[model samples]
Target: MRDTAKAFGEGPAASIYAGFADLVSIGTCIAEWHAAVVAATSDADRFLRAAKEKASIWLKEYAGREHLLALGEIAANVSSVSTSDDGKAVLSKLAKQPLPLGIFASHPKERPIFDGDHRSVGKEKPKLAVAFVEFTIDGRPVADIQHMAPNVTHDLELHIRISRWPEKAERLVLTPLSVESATLYQLPTFKVSAPSGDPPFTFSVRERAVFSVPQSFFSRPLEFKYGAEFQPLSVEQPVEVVGQRTLRLESVDWQRNPQTGYANIDQRILRIRDELRRWPTVSQDERAICLKLLVNLAKHVGQAVQDNVFPGVWSEGQFQIEVRKALRNDPSIGSALQEHPRSAGGIGDLMFQGVPIELKVETNRTLALEDCKKFIKQTTSYAVGNGKRIGILCVLDTSPKVNPPFPMEEGIGILFREADGYVLPVVTILIQGNLTPPSHFSR
Candidate 1:
């Protein structure tokens, strides 16, 4: 019973072995096909050699005929040369004379010895005659020759000087010399006068000439910045002034007086008291400075206003002083007034990020200064609160030599650490000579 059970399990294993044998038979058939493809590829090299030999034989048989056909096609497309009237005239002149002979002798002794004897030796002895012709054409020396005759056979001796030869063969042709052909040759040297100068320059005998000029003749001194001028008000208003002043700071005009070597500044200022009466709130310091500026301007332009030369109304000092007293009593106004400039600084233009900045002004000096200081203080406080830094980039247009009193005329100074524990970084840049973007900051 144990043997019968073992045989029953082996029966399934035998069927699986039969299935694998069928798969192996199919793989053997694919291998045979791949071997046949390799054998065909191996024969291709021999076949290509036979094809190349056949093509070479065909080309050799037809090469001459193919070349002649190609030449015919090219000739059909090209234009033929026609003789012009000048060319015909030249040919007519040549037809009248006998063909010229060309001879070259290395030794002076070998040169023809012509003692007025036209006859030398008869037949069997070569007869020779020395025909000396110093030829020139268009004033240029062509050839100096002593021709030996009897050997001269053609219409023209194609003898050409290597240096003076035509660049193109079509321009001049050289043919064998013969009788009835005229020979014209150019001389080697032509006289040319030198340009008018200290030493009269002269040229040697040659095919071409060259001349030169002195370097001093082409150079001159260059003058720049002649009679250039600018206005003071157009000069950069201090950053402080730009932020504070109430002066309706108008545009600046630069005018020059050629006779006086001076520039006049026309600072346009408009005084409107009605606008002043409408201010709801203003600091006492601003009112005081405004009053002082008006009082000073009045005294300066008093005669001009009276004479009708200047057009503007002057303010009352008493009314200005009273307004200042009222502003001083207010706590908020007093705090804001404390930040104004302690001393008057020269006016300068405003610039930011290397560009000019425009601002509206009230034409009030004290108010302008106060606004400028307030801006500085606010920027300072903001920097302090955020732990960040503030930088001031000052740009000036004038030369430091003329505007020596201006603060920026001096080289830039940076203010970094503040005494009140508020730190701000200020960079003052002076733009003097050329209006080039500041190199101090990198893009």
Candidate 2:
């Protein structure tokens, strides 16, 4: 059962991921990182080891330096119990169990050190190259690094398959333990006899990058409305058999942005904003979200909300949150958008659909055309400075006097677009009526 209210952003961690914008840069990195790791490797042995080591270091910031010691502890934990007469039991338990996934602040689960569950087929008899690590996000593989070489062939191939979720915050998170390889017994604990290679590395959550599921992904008590699909993040990704083949990574040469502050702003935030500038290039899912947002705000002179979401209090911040939440769903809305002016809120409310959207809460009921025209003086600069063609001005009218022709639903009229470019279309959505059953804005 899912808590229907979860559709509304509510909870302790709700603000952590204000919307999809919070995950843009990280998600892109994870997707591209897996591809690079596989393309850089020559054999399954290298791929498996590299996946753990690279993803760990890549996510060093989030997982922290403490994870390094955690890996060693995990090696000891698994090896102590690994010397069984039949390794199948060890493999069986490893197969059944996976790394930690769900996170419940109220009732947290026990987290272990390393989460590398593996199998051992004699090296002499190599299995067809399988996934050294079938790269996954939330139990679904989003990309392919190198594959297990058939007969230790060392062949490689890469494939990326990204999934789309209905919610904005459902963006992907790359785990440290996501790997599939041709070589069985890839876990650090399985290496009984030392091999001649780079230093023998052990796999552990501590040694690697392990992202706790975002609070948004936390499953609700009923698993709806108030929560996300909370699944357990396992130590090892589920392994599967596949044909060995050579593959190439996406041609994208991904790298962290250089530290060039755009007037004292963080480089990470700038790069994400750069990506957002390219939002028109993304898919059309935003139209659905925009429509939903508009209908909700207009329902009963209030809001119709997303799919099943009901009308709640409509404030300027609430409008900003909903717009951020809605626009974040567009694949192109790839910026960890934040409030303007670091601490002090500025004229601009926030970024949505990759553009800065200003929320104008009409304190008075009567909103005439002249009032909207005056607002352009305040918002046109954001569009001009950001080089955006669309200027979003969301006006929430708690009173219903000068409504109608003033723009209800989405009013796209001529605004200003600084220099040469498309007409700066200011999308004005009017949400009228106070507590009364005022009709939707018309003509």
Candidate 3:
């Protein structure tokens, strides 16, 4: 059970798996239990004699009519077994005899401690890291390499799926590299059947590593999260890989900034911050925090489009509720409030850290410049009412048209609104709706 819990994060089914180590452990425990029982009982012969006398006294005082009848029957059957009769014949006759109800009520049934249902239980799978290692042809590191295909400059991509975690440490150790097409695997050079004594490869977080690969080594394209044309070695591979480690989490100092070398910061929270850096804004520090909270919203909506989750066109308010759920579901942005009341009487669609976010949906069509202008004004009002300079406006383009996806920078823009002789920018981010699948494009 311990091994099962370690391997598959399940404990209840461990009893079915009786390995050599489990038998040895069980034997040792049983031996110790027998020793303890003997010590407690002192002399076994004396203990049995006293137990028999106590049973006789209990039978004499409280034996009911049915109990007395069962005792008489058992005694007569035993007496019938003469010294001349065979042992097998006497045992067979005793087994065939019908016994009275509750005949063994005087003594409790002895059961092994491990046989109880309270022994173990299944546990939820632990949050393990999903890692992907990519090697380029030109030795230049590329961002979002998992989504991109192997072009002239870029070559083969090797993905390693590792399940084991080191004890007491949070590091995700990638197992040895393997390419099924090739015979041998080497850590350095990334070539199959390389010379022996190649140094092992080590990976670090937020750092890049370059490796040399032989020409024409990787002819076939490797599989990706969205690109399912290339089959994976195993079905248990993660859809996407993020360089995050499952460390023993400790209490964090909430007052301190995570960017300033805080040790106890969650990697997922840091990942949101990393996504915020890619967002185009003038005040990256102040306005960017709002984008961090919206990262899950954008991704969730984007995935829904990719997976064709929506059955029909949803209302603007419905989109608002869904976006609110997406943000709230994220542990990093669990405090996102929906329909927060503004000081100027009306309620903002959503509020996070005193900033208001307005949501809009364009039914059956994509969002245009005019659509953003109308919504930005409303979002700006909510921001100014809440005593803030910047606000966010998210428009869900629920268009049924099969349009090409827009780049992140193109979908996001800053619209300036002047109030009280001061200019404030409302970050308008457009989420593309009803996008055609990549497979459809191939057809």
Candidate 4:
């Protein structure tokens, strides 16, 4: 048995460890066998059989019993004795020495430290604003305060109760309220107020979704040309007559045709000619209407011309290329144009890269003097706003030009000496002709 124990200890197989365990159980059984051997005479075999069976069962059931078996194997080898009394003495000595108590002694009971269902507020409590606490024991609700050491604020409320048999410890459940204020070190120096007053107005994300196109999209230059010889008509009132006489005379004078019953009607032609000669003097209303229509048409044409020029794309490729190249060559104009493409032409003129010009046209019909003044003021304002120094270019399209007595610099007012007058004012920023660079030169 001692040699067998030594062989088992030296073996590499895990089953050797099991064999060592069996060796220990066998030693214990041998102690029982010694008793049986001492007490029984003929039934010693039965005693030995029962002791072996009990030892085998114990070796199989005990955890880490293999380690004990290994120790037993060593002791048995050293003793090298076959007597059951020696085996009993070895077992008793091994039992007397202290053995490991294992992990069962210091094992802790598993329980949640934090109550997950309760909310805590104020100083010294859990940082979470909202939470829930739950307590239970023996598969039942055991709300006990003693078992839990909760660092709670004054605002919190604790709920406690008993749940299971054999009362172990008080289970605690904590609930927190909205904390109005909390002080440091439990000091009463500060107080907080509950949220009051109306909620602040908030802008909706959708409100800023409006789409807008840039002003540059609609910017362009407008040009108006006025032919010379325009003039203003004089206003004349109809004279009132003191008395008038109605005469009815019957003259049976007639002209007859000499051929095919058709008359030459030379006398009727003469009478019609006479009436036509007097028509202008008799029909003042028709003359007024004609004058008004002419004025309206002139106004419409001027506006239309402005509309055509301003914010208009170049229709001719040549024009577009020339303008683009010119702008690129002039540093000031090019820089301005690069910032706002719509102001390209105007910027060019303002920078003296091109000839700055303005033109206006008016028909024979006269506009109110105040209206003309207003027009001049507005045009000046617009020019100044656009960063340009402007001067008027007047054109007379009628027989005699209406020139105002005031200087053109003061306001573009024109006075006329004859009827059927047409006039226009062109506002322009003058570019120095001498400053024009060579066509080949680049800015």
Full-model lDDT for every candidate: 0.26, 0.34, 0.46, 0.29
Model 3: what TM-score?
0.35
Query: Candidate 3 on 114-188: residue-level lDDT in tens?
Result: 436566434443434345554432344434322122111334334433333322332332333232223211222
The TM-score that candidate 4 achieves is: 0.16
Highest TM-score model number: 3
The ten-residue window of minimal lDDT in model 3 covers: 222-231
Measured against the true structure, the TM-scores of the candidates, in listed sequence, are 0.13, 0.26, 0.35, 0.16
lDDT score, candidate 1, position 305: 17
Candidate 1: give its CA RMSD in angstroms.
41.1
For model 1, the superposed segments whose C-alpha errors exceed 4 Å read 1-375, 384-387, 393-408, 416-422, 428-443
Q: Report the backbone clash tally of model 3.
A: 0
lDDT, candidate 3, residue 213? 31
Candidates in descending TM-score order: 3, 2, 4, 1
Off by over 4 Å in 3: 1-285, 336-338, 368-371, 407-409, 418-421, 436-443
The lDDT-based order of candidates, best leading, equals: 3, 2, 4, 1
For 1-443, candidate 1 gives per-residue lDDT tens digits of: 22222223434332223222322232232333333233322232332333234334433433455323332222222122122332233223323323212232232232343457674433231211111122222243432211111222212211112112111222221111212112222112222222233321222222421112111111111111101111232432211101110111111112321111121101111121212222323222332333322322222222221232212222333323433443455443443332122111322122222211111212222121122333344334433332323423222222212221222112222334355754444322222221123342344
Tens-place lDDT digits, model 4, residues 1-443: 33333334333333444444555565665665665455332344554565456554544454365556644444434234356655556666555544332222132223334447855442321111111122222233322211111122222121121111111212111112211122211211111112223322111111001111111101111111111110111211111111111111111123221111112222222232223223322222322222222222233223322232222222233333433454455443454333211232333212122122122333433333333433343333333344433312222221122332221122222221122452222232111111122332443
Ten residues in a row with the worst lDDT in model 2? 217-226
